[model samples]
Target: MKKIKPLFLLLILNTISYAQGCSDAGICSVGNSFSNEIQESKNGIELGSIFGKGEADVISISSYITYTRNFSERFSLSGKVTYSQASGEFGTRGQFGDAYAIGNYKFKKMTNKQWSSLFGFKFPFSSANLKINGYPIPLDYQASLGTFDAIVGITFNYKKWDFNSALQLPIINNNKNSYFKEYSGTDDFPSTNLFERKPDVLFRSNYTLKTTNQKFTFRPNLLFIYHLGEDSYKNIFGNRERISGSEGLTINGNLITSYSINSKSSIELSLATPFVVRTIRPDGLTRSITAGFTYKRSF
Candidate 1:
């Protein structure tokens, strides 16, 4: 294809639908994104793709289609949809992932520093229950989290640096998964049956370096994602059990480079890796490393 897209909105850390499947799912890359930008038109679209290695060396891939409508200099809205897949020891699976819609409002004041508020939501196509051989697969294998989540975030810019923070709250969890430890192939990755995920709070900081002509840009980013509480799942007895140690933080380091093909279009490459990790990630948001590309245009 000619292009691909980016977002929890990322594990936008794993880097939107992780920067297509990057962020926690698509949270970090919505609305007025946290990355460096050279806005050339009021309406725009992007195609992005992500390739990653997750737990147990599962090879994962995702693609996205994104559209943005800029109402003015201070406001904009964006919609992104994604499809994801993976191949591990078990088998290969692919499907549409989540959909996100976000609105952003930039503060009118603060000339030296621009402040923007972000709000959005995630809609899943599957219930985190992708199955094979009559059994539910691990989260890393499924394309969607099967949860409806609300997202709110803020972005602040000072010169070449941008700071962003976001919260993703699960308004409804419809995950009907049944991948238990018993289904494991002699390895104990946690059971995700009836997985009940907690809220996530994420922070990101990045610095942008651009050439004198502003045609090429380089960015280094750091992301921190914290699980608000321990996740839970129903056991065989139907008892809700908390997955201990599920409440913690994951840290990722990201690097990005972009090329401006013209005034109305551009191309970007992003890379991310986990520098710090949690012991147990049952939410299916785990990734060891990620790489992706985005082609953007303003019209």
Candidate 2:
């Protein structure tokens, strides 16, 4: 156990280093909108619903409400709520929800510009309950986890075409440990008393291109997520050693089209897919597709 401590620390450090260097890393960003827990569309006052599907018998349903209000033309406040449910055949089913509030301050404003810079802090709160099958021998149990994250990011926007890029980082995170570990027969699960607080790092980029007549917009995005501390998972039924990790990565792509009718309201349709790039096997190789619509009434 003492020797394993060094190895575990090394893994955690490596994950953080890689997350910080994602821009230079060769990992290709997937192209798609609606693939993210947080919507990439940077607009004021939007509401939408999302439905996602994937191979391996997976399904997800979600709804979102977002509002952005500008202050003094250079500062803005944005908030969003996402409620989602995900279920898979490989002994996984759960419901998760996230709520975030961000403050944006524009540094440079360019008229008809192709690029701009905005800085902001994101406060993300998440909660989930998951269950695994073939566990505890014929009985299933619920496991829950919750987290609070403090994040910051900078965004670059283009005007001639609807395109944007962003990079975000989490400076602080508060996670619940009891929700992640399971009990063992001989060795009791570590008490939550020893849990430690840690931060996560994430990188994201998004771009939008409009076709002729501006009837359709193509949006693509990439996100790389890395957790910096140990998280534990157990198979109580198997009576084996628990699995623990401090790092993982996910890649996603999406395409969406918006059709305008009058002026105040438009209809949007989207398809999104996400893949786990690097992580523990079985739990890492997962994919999903989401199709949804947006209806807006301008005030």
Candidate 3:
């Protein structure tokens, strides 16, 4: 029994969701978000799934688990993992995504307002063997970027409203990708090459309204994402190819609700839709819905 324990734990970790990026699950940051109403929370866990549907019959399902620990009155740390599977007319794929560690600090406080800052790091700790029909998948479809990134942000809270802004930037290049390929004159060419990706900047805000009994609450949120630049691909011939229509802005709106089962647990549901798209996005998500259950225990 003891010898099997390590393998059993590894299997469980492999199945854990490694969710990343900003899809329909509100604004996904690198840490335990600082927008929670219960500021006194010492420990918490969140588990959820999100379903996304897009054009060309494309569909995505993602699962996630997050753990948070607060060591002091004004500081906290969080960790999360995700797994996802996506399918469309092209093909299907399932793999682990990314992992994150975040630290948050409350820097200022006032009568009805508070300010906080956050910084974190995301590790591309997943297997890079993701494929579709035995062929390498594109960056948009792959489960992991195979690179490390840094996350930084700030938050402002006033009354029942919370505003958050964050930046995600890749600090390293992925040179181990063997997926990029181009067609030659009459045959297909394959190469294990490097990939260059742009940074993502996001701004999100939400307003919450609760019932008198505080058992039911409703929240509406808006998220905006801006891609900084165009992504590049290096072919086997050492020539760089610019991927067109890859950089743009996306705006999404979400309607969220929560029902408290008790003080220690709650159930939440949400629906998100794209409000505005500034560029031609290929395989972009048009709508998504998410359901989550949360358990919180203060120590």
Candidate that would win on lDDT: 1
Query: Taking the tens digit of each residue's C-alpha lDDT, what string does model 3 give over 1-299?
Result: 35434533433242232212254212353423775455466787887777655443456776778788888768888888877777865578777777778888886578889998888877765434466666665444556666677888998889989888888887875534545545322112223346666777888887777777988776667788887886666776779866676688877555566778787777776555555654533223233333333443433
Cα RMSD for candidates in order: 5.9, 12.5, 10.6
Ranking of candidates on TM-score, top first: 1, 3, 2
Q: What is the lDDT of residue 130 in candidate 3?
A: 67
lDDT assessment of candidate 1: 0.77
Q: What is the lDDT of residue 171 in candidate 2?
A: 45
Deviation of model 3 at 220, angstroms: 0.9
Give the range where candidate 1 is weakest over 10 consecutive residues by summed lDDT.
1-10
Q: Give the TM-score of candidate 3.
A: 0.78
User: Estimated TM-score per prediction?
Assistant: 0.89, 0.56, 0.78
lDDT of 2 at 140: 14
Q: Which ten residues in a row have the lowest lDDT in candidate 2?
A: 23-32
In candidate 2, position 183 carries an lDDT of 47
Question: Please, what are the lDDT tens digits per residue for candidate 2 over residues 97-203?
Answer: 45556665554456644333344443333322233452321001111123444444444455423343343443443422322233423221232321233344555
The candidate with the higher lDDT, 1 or 2, is 1
lDDT of 1 by residue, 66-165 (tens): 9988887777888999999888877899999999988878786465587788888899999989887776788888888889999998888898788999
Better of 2 and 3 by TM-score: 3
Output the number of the TM-score-best candidate: 1
